[model samples]
Every structure is written in structure tokens, then in C-alpha cells.
Target: MAVRKKKKDRRYSKGCNNQALLPRGSKGWPMIGESFEYFGAGWKGHPEKFLHDRMSKFSSLVFRTSLMLEDVAVLCGPQGNKFLFSNEKKLMQPWLPTTIAKIFPSSQETFNSGNSKFRKLLINVLKTEALQQFVPIIGDVAQQYFESKWKGKKEIMAYELAKTFTFELACKILLNIYDPELIKYLFGPFEAIGKGFLSIPIDFPMTPYRRAINAAKFIRKELVAIAKQRKIDLNEGKATPTQDILSRFIVYRDENGEFPGEDEIADQIQGLLIGGYENMSTTCAALVQFLAELPEIYHGVYNEQTEIAKCKAPGEQLEWSDLSKMNYSWKVAREVIRLTQPSQGYRQVMTDFMYEGYSIPKGWKVYWTALSTHKNPELFPEPEKFDPSRFEGNGPEPYTFVPFGGGAHLCPGKEYARLAILVFIHHLVTKFKWEKINADERIVYNPLPHPAKGLPIRIYPHIS
Candidate 1:
């Protein structure tokens, strides 16, 4: 009699709670939740498998899981992406793992109050018109980089070379830091920060998360010093207000006529540096690998770039107009990004919502992955096959190929990344022919995708 009474009470309790109707699936083990399996698939270099498995077993469009100790809804496919992206600031808001807040303490304040304003400041320099003026500067940097780093080497690690080149470009253009030694010195802690940024937020000694906190502290000190000096220079007219991003930040006054503090400026600068570093570098390394594997594609790019090269006198820098002619090259880059999508968008549910007859309670986390749409057979035929022609027409349907995400919070550096990739492609193929040293090298994601062996390749200068 007591057992029957208890069963009836349980049913009544569940009927009163909206969460009982959450999309189908398990939250996995407690404490860790599904984070192990969630990141495990990424570690195995096929992050799509996690979503693919769940989509097949449960619902294809949405499911429930837990990650980082929070109940999460994994929204799948183009429809899912459109829903989340289109509803930004309405039904959803940006969210980062708790680990980020613990490391960059200033991030929460910025995220809450100054995100839009800060993003506008960043977009000012990355917009197409602004990026147009930097084409020749990038061209010059690429030329000097190749001469110093790749001129005579018979073999080279493509990933390592790409990292250094992108880092130097970011430092010189963004921070106005030109000293090789200073850049090199800063690289170590910055790299530590990258490795620790998305790590599980455990603060124990010697852990990646702990190291990242320490590294961020060190970087904060360095940036604070830099910001303080820049502020002085700006007041004395010793530095131009538009000289670089640091100067611009120093001169910026918000609507309240207040300058952002040193800590906030440091945090934002670090974000930009890392933002421009890892993903662009990954794209560049993978671009090298794909171009080497596909000679037909290489020739297509080489032909286009050569025509542009012929139009210029010896040592002339590439103009913004030249980039427009390399459509096929850009298409190839897009396909590379599709095959190896680097980011996953995370959001927090802002209110109770109903979608596809499922209940999503407020405070639950939401994830929209590019892998689902990028690799879906229905959305992209023969998705594993590398075909640049997919982008030839009007392109993949809206939200299906979001290499840089979508909606109100689109990546601010999108145009800048495009310019950097095209400039690198021009310099790479027009100057040399290369073949992969390891034909079967595998890609692994240690929090981010990279070649298992750094992608070594044999270099042969094109016969002029």
C-alpha cells in the first residue's frame, strides 16, 4: 500500500515539472557529466561522432545531455543553428564554460556590460575597408617571412611555420610589437593561456587550468604595463591615436566618457591576440596539407595567383583588388574549414521555450555545432569529399556552413582572416611547390585541431 502511494506521488510530482519533458537522452555520470565523452570524441579527431551517435539513437534535431556539470540541450542541423543564432539576445545569450571566468576574471564584467561596444571597437579595424589598406602590409610581411624562414629549407613543419608567421603578423599589426625577442618572450605564456583556456576548471597544482591562470596573470601584468605606458604616450602626443590597436584602446572613451581600465584593456587585447592566433593558424596549416594533396586545386590557385603576380612589377605588394581574382582559392579555403570546423557555439537558455514539442527550461545550456550541418548528408552531399564546387553557386543553405558562426555575434575578425589566408596562399604557391613528407599524417585536437606531427613537407621552389 505504501509503495503504491509513493508511485502515485512521484507521477504527480513529475507532471508538475516542465523539465520532465526535456528532449530525450541521458546526462551520463554525475560530477563529470558527459564532458569526458563530449571532449573524448574531439580528442579522437572525429568530434562529429558524438553528435552523430546521439542523433541516430534519439532525436535528430535535439537531445539532452550534461557538460561541465550543467544540463545541456544539443541542438542539431541547420534548423537548430538557425533557431539559436536567430534568437540571440531574445531566447538565448552567449555563454562560456565556467573555466573561462575563473581564468579571466575581467571577462564577466566585459561580457555583461561592454560586449557590444568592445566588439565595435574591434570590428572597426577588421572591416573590409579597413582591411583593404593592410593588404600590401601583409604582402610585405609574407615576403619577408618566407625569405627568412622558408627560403632555403628543403623540409619544414608547416604548422609551426604558420603559427610563428600568424603570431608575428598579429603582434606587428595589432600591438605594434616589432622586437623579435619581446615577441618570443611573450609567446610562451600566451601559448600556455591557449592550452588552458578551454580546459576543465580544476585549480589543483600543475594542472593545465592552474597553469593557464598563472599565465593569464603574467600576461595581465605585461599588458597593464603596456597600457599604462601607451596612455602616457597618448596624453603627451608621443604616439598617434591610430597607430595600432593598443593606441586606439587607450584613446577610446565610452559613452560615459570613461576610458576602460588597464585590466579590462589587457583582457580585451589578450582575447584579440588569441582569437587571431589559433584558428587562423589552424586554417593555414590545413590549407597547406589540402593544397599539397590536390595538385589540380594547387594549379588552379597557382594560375590565378600567377596572373595577379604578372600584373605587378618585381617586389610590388599585392593590392586588395588582387584578392578578388582568386575566387577559386577562397572556395578551397572554405571547403577546408568545413571539413575541419574549429569552434562550437555555446549559449545559455534565457527563458522557457518550446521547440518541436520539447520543453527547454531556463538556465539550461545550449550547444550548436557546425559538424552536424557541415557533415549532414542531406545538407551536404558526400560531405567527407573535398569539393570546392559546393560553394560555387549561391553556396550552402543559410546557417549550414558557419565556419565563423552567425547572427548578431559574428566573429569580428572574419575579414581579417580572409585577407591573411589569401595573402599566404599567394605567397606559398607562387613561390614553391610542396609535397607532404608524411602522406598519411592524422589530425588530432588537443583542445584544437592540428596535425599529429606538425605537418612536415618537402619544399621545391617553382622554376622561374
Candidate 2:
């Protein structure tokens, strides 16, 4: 039932066949396309509605449209994930809007090998060996975060609190900057950069984009100063080359004696900071929301964490072994991620290719929605339900669940994020029992999901 056609030069030589080869669906109103509706559906809690409705209406595996003023093909289900992920850097590569590029650029272009050396060298520092030692570091950061920020609070905004904690941890783990005043100062401007990642790119004075640019400039200046100091420390034998990413960037040398220049080091670390800060914060907020709403699930997680907490004396550092025993806690975290994915993946077509017996023109954008695969009944029966047990033994089908993305583009900081979140959850569940102040709070998905009003929860500190 599939029709195939040769792709012809189409600015003029158009016909119904040209349309037929491109799949079925309106490109929507020129320029804006169906983006508003796409965002609306997500903001309204049916994030996958756009794809579902189009698949039904067009009766096709793919739907062609213009998103963000670019020709895009939104592919559906796990088959789509397989094709897009498998063909990464071969048939497709990341091609996001300029707004995203302005905030963090190298990530989308790593597929080209044009700028990969810089990124790969930087990621080399965040290897498993380095992260394996960060367990106690994150645990200690969590303990302090809870003591200073959460212990005495009657009510607090979960998103705000999580944002601070995640950002602080990122600074400590990635940059080795733990000064309280510096964290407080950087926190305010970074909010603008975070906002501008999804905002329209109008770089006028006072605009989010402009403010974000300004913030990036300031942060880059600070990073340059930090990197210079690190270089001196490395030369003086005053700092370990592997102490932090800054130090690693200072010391890393390739076989060719090439090293990341100071500017490239700043950009690379900035990308890691942007990535680690946002996803972890949103995910932590989601966990707080879920734990508040589902007491049975909370008790299950609480018991698991409390058993671990009970074994440790007050003020003792958590060992990597502690993280190993919280299997069920990890399950709950995975399910929370599935139920509320942080963002969708977008890739650009590299060469003209055939998929499922249809011609896909080169230079077009293709998107893989995580929600599409996560909610598919074929992969997860009753996908709406939050069943951590589903992940207890074997977990969901491969490529069918990609909360942290998959294939060549899997998030590099994934394990670190996992450990940080688990440690935070361990601290949270063992010490506090919380309930949402606004039980009916709704979620908004600009690029990631967070409560519309920033989830506010009343906390009851444990007295054990």
C-alpha cells in the first residue's frame, strides 16, 4: 500500500506525485506552520496528540509539515525511532532552530565531525571512572542542599528548589566552583539563557535572546578567567589534572598534541552545564510532583530509601554501594521520566533516502517524539499508568523507551544525572513527607515539562 517516487528538483517541477512522495499532511499556514497547535496539545497534557491525530487523518507513517519555518517530516512510533536513530549522521543529523543553537550549538553539529573533536575531548573527562567517584560528592551536596534549603520550610516551590540544587551540583561536579556568592550571582542571569533556548530569536535590548546573549558573554568571561587560573594551577602542580572539567580541559592532550583551546573549553563546559541543569531540574520537579500525588508509590520509594538511610549514621558520606541497593527508587525515577519526558529529538536529513518504500527528500528536517514511543500501547500496555514494577526486572523494549534519548546522541551526562537524581531522591524521601499545595497543578511543555505555577509542596520533615 506504499507508493514510491523519484525525487525531482521541486521549486518548479511540481506535480501531485511530488506531493505523494513527500507523505500526506498540510504544511499548515505558511511560516508559522502547525507549531502553535503542536505546542498547545503538549501544554494541554496531550503532548502526543498532534502525531496521533495526523497519523489517523493521513494514514501514513510520516506526516510532512513546516515547523519553525522549515520543512519537517514528523515520524511516528518505534519504527520511526529506529530509522532516525539508526541513520544518525548517515541519513540525518540535528537541525534545530537558531534559537537553540544560540544557547548551545555544538551538540547538534557533532554528527558532522566538523566540531566533534572538541566535544569528544571534553566528554572524555566525564567518563565512568570520573563519575564513579562523584557519588559521595553529589550525596554531600544533597545533604547540604536539604539542610540549608528544605529542612525548615513549611511550603516551597519544588521547581525553584530543584533548579537551585541541580545548578549548584552541576557547578560543583563540572566546574569545581563551590563559592556560595558566585552560585547566587550566576543563578539570576542563567535564568535568561534558559528561557531564550526556547524563545523566539529577537535579539533586541531587554529581549530574552539579547539578555541570554549577554548572560552567555558574562559566563564565558568568568569561565575564561577560571580556565586560565586552572592552567596556572596545573603548571604549578597545585591542582590535579582530573580534579574537575576545567582542570581536565586544561590538561587533556590528543595523540597529535592538540588540546581544546581556552574558548572551546568554555563552550564545551557551557553546553554540559546547560544540559545537566535543565533536564535534572525538570526531572527532579516531576519526581517531587509524582511522589506528592501518589502516596502508595511514595511509601514504596520511601521504604527503599529509608532502609538505606537507616544503615548510614548521621553525617556519613554515601558510598556507591548505597546507590546500588535502591533498585526500586531507580524504577520509580525511570517511570517518572517515561510519564513525563523532558524533550523531543529533531534530526536533519543528510541525503535523499527511501524509507518504508517512500522517497524522503534530502535537506528536510525529521523529528522523533519520545512521547509517541512512550505512550504506545504496543510497547507498554496501559502506558498511562505509572507502574514502576514494569521496570523491576527487564524493563521496556529497547528503543521503545528513550527518556534520555538513544543511539549516537544519547546524553553523555546520563549516568551522572541518574546518580544525582537518585541521591537527591534518597535525601528527599528519607527526610521529608510532602503534599502538593495545589493538587490540580497542570504541566507546561515548552521544551521540557514543569508545573505551570511551579509545583508548590508543603513539607513535613521526618523525626527519626
Candidate 3:
């Protein structure tokens, strides 16, 4: 919470160097800062409370605070969101907590400087043409996944089950690793990694941080082995360069004509899987939770999906064409994500700058929260209400409804995530009707939002 004092230099006398120009908000407790209060609100399932309370008290669009021992400015509303998203690498730079580097040491450079290149690679693989081929493939996987894990079950934990579906899909579509045993073995470490990202960075043995580091090592070693064999297969003409992301990364060279090392490739693959699985799985779970609560909305989605289903021959999988017709279903999914955005995006100040007359000091962090913007009555009327119709036309203004972020930092795998979600919904609505087992399941954020009881739900198969 310590703000740098004015130095003898005249330039330091102005802008953020002058403490008086700093945003108005308490840093909370020393060292611990407002970390507890900030996260506590999220854990209570009202993350917007933390932002709204401060906004009301300060009467400002920007406020200073501290979290994880770093000073921050919590930027509010669409203007703040636009500034950060539009000024990326200019006024602000993407940042990861120190713990992220400690956990995945080998890929630190990739996470830092090479992130754009990594994103470009992902966009190449997940582009529309590439994803068209995956629609039916994802449908086939979702069908089998539902039949085995969801079919004939009276009640099931939706969030936990959704995690399985997303992880299996990541393994299948991204790495082309379809071995159930290997996928199951890989799942544990990935879960540990997710839990450790925002945990205390103390690396003491048995701590979440230490466990995550060890888990990263285990996953990296396994991925390296996989990448190495993939390289051999590519050289022997047994595998095509475009076969899967694993093969693509093994064969891909940067603009400088440098191919990533096996260890680095492994780290990047792990990053992609972590990024892909966590948010998408949460979206899938939230979709289920929302649909269960609103039978009318669920019925609308069912009608839309069933209409698409009626066109397909018996046992025929969903096609790319069918996905376009899933307009209403996508809107429902969009609303789910808007109301329950996984986590706020973080950016580091690239240089001292003035925003809304408040000085943002270089080296400090900035947080543009989706919950605040998403739930703002100004941007979204009855923001607390579940209204899929809000997304009917052009949708909530450009930067106001950022579920996958915006501009350059926008999630590269957004298309793929959409495809995956729609496929799951298509197969789900067409096959079964489900209701929440717990009428009031709380959502908790372990840095990522998840239903507290894993969103258990009862299912009933539709009559043939």
C-alpha cells in the first residue's frame, strides 16, 4: 500500500509522483492490504459489492488499493475497460502474478514477451475453418461423455462433470491424446495448478504453491515426453504438421525461424490447456445452473436446439451449419458468462499516466472488473436479472459485455470455446431435461468461479 514519495526531481513533482493525485480508496490492512475483503466479497458470491461499495464511497471511476502485496487501481465501468483494452502495450502491459512464474518457470518468457506469438499460434489452430471440422468431432465427444457420465444418473455434480468434459475435449482436440487413463492422470495436476495460481506465493513444502510447482514439474515432464515422441513421428512422416496442437507446436517456427524447444513447447501446451479448460468448464457449469433455474429460458433453448436436432438424421452429429442456427442458445450462454465472469483481467502500468484525472504510477497494477461493468444498471438495465434477450441484437455495447476480454488481449480460443459450449448444449437439450438438485447453490471463487457443491443437478431423459 506504500505509494512512492515525491523525489527531488521536478518531473516526479507532477503526475503520479505527487501522492495527492492518486486515486481515492484505502489500501486496507498493511501488507495484507484489502486482499481479504476483496476476495471475501467474491467468495460470498457478490463480487460486485466490493466494487460498488468503493465506487459509491469514493464517487470516482478509479480507486487505489492493494492485493497480493501489490498496489492497484480498480478501474470501473466501460470507459475504464475500453482504456485498458485499447491501450495494451501502450499505457499498460499484460501481467501475471509472480506465483505464475514460480509455478511454470520454463514458460515465463512465453508468458511474458512471447505471449502474442503464442496467441497467434492458437488463433491459427482455432480459426473458423479449423474449428468447423471440430464441431462434429466435439459433438461426438460430448455425446459419448454424456452417455457415460451423465446418462441414467439421478443427480450429478454439474461443475465437476463439466470439468471432465472440458479436459477430455482439450486433450482430444488440442493434443490428440485420447487415452482415458492418460487424460485422467493429467487431470489431477491441472486441477492443482488452477488452485495454486492465486494462492500465497510462499513455496514452502506442502503449501499450495509448492504443490503447484511440483505439479507443474510433473506435467512438464510428461508433456516433454509427449512432444519428443511427436517430433519423432513428424520426422518419420507418421504425423502431419497440422495433426494436432502438439504436432503443430513441435513443427512451428517463429517469425525469426526458431522452433520452440520441447520444454518450452510443453509449457506453452500446458498454458493453452489451463487457459482453455478452466473458463470453458466454468461456462458449461454456469450454463447448466442458469438453464435449470429458468425453465422458460431452458424451454426456449430446447426448442431452438431441438429444431436443429430435427434436421439431422438419427445418430447424425451436429454440423458447422447447425451451430449458426443456435442463435438463441448462444445468447443464453452469453448471459451466463456475463453474470458469472470467471475472474477480472489484470494489467500492469507500462508508464505513469493520467486516467480520469487520476495518476496511475508505473509498476503498479490495474484491474478492470467485469462484474462491476456487467452488473451496472447504467450499462445493463436490471443487471442482476437473468435476461438472455439483452444479447438479442448487436448486444450490450462493445466493451461493456466482455466475457472473454477485449481488443488485443481478448482470448484467442473464443471461437473454439463457443463451438464446444454449443455442442454440449445441443446434445444436452436435445437429450435431457435437468433441474438443480440444490435450489440455492453458492458460487465460490478459487480464483475461478465454481458452484460450491459443484452444482449437483437431477436429470430426466426426454421420451423418444
C-alpha positional error of residue 132 in candidate 2 after TM-score superposition, expressed in Å: 1.8
Clashing pairs in 2: 93-348
Across 1-464, the per-residue lDDT of candidate 1 in tens digits comes to 44654333221113225534668888899788888998888888888888889999988999988888888899998889888778889988888778887888877766644377677888887889988767877887799988988889999999988888898888877787888899888888888888888887779999988999999889889988989988888889888887788888877889899988888888888878888888888998999999999899899989988998999999999888888998999999999899876568678888888777787878888987788888888889988889999999899988899888888778888999999999999999999999999999867776688888999999999889
**TM-score: model 2 vs. ground truth:** 0.92
For every candidate structure, what is the RMSD over all alpha carbons to the true structure, in angstroms? 2.5, 4.0, 3.8
Clashing pairs in 1: none
Question: Per-candidate TM vs. native?
Answer: 0.94, 0.92, 0.94
- For candidate 2, the per-residue lDDT at 70 reads 79
What local lDDT does model 2 show for residue 240? 89
lDDT (C-alpha) at residue 444 in model 1? 75
What value of lDDT does candidate 1 attain over all alpha carbons? 0.85
Better of 1 and 2 by lDDT: 1
Q: What's the ranking of the predictions by lDDT, best on top?
A: 1, 3, 2
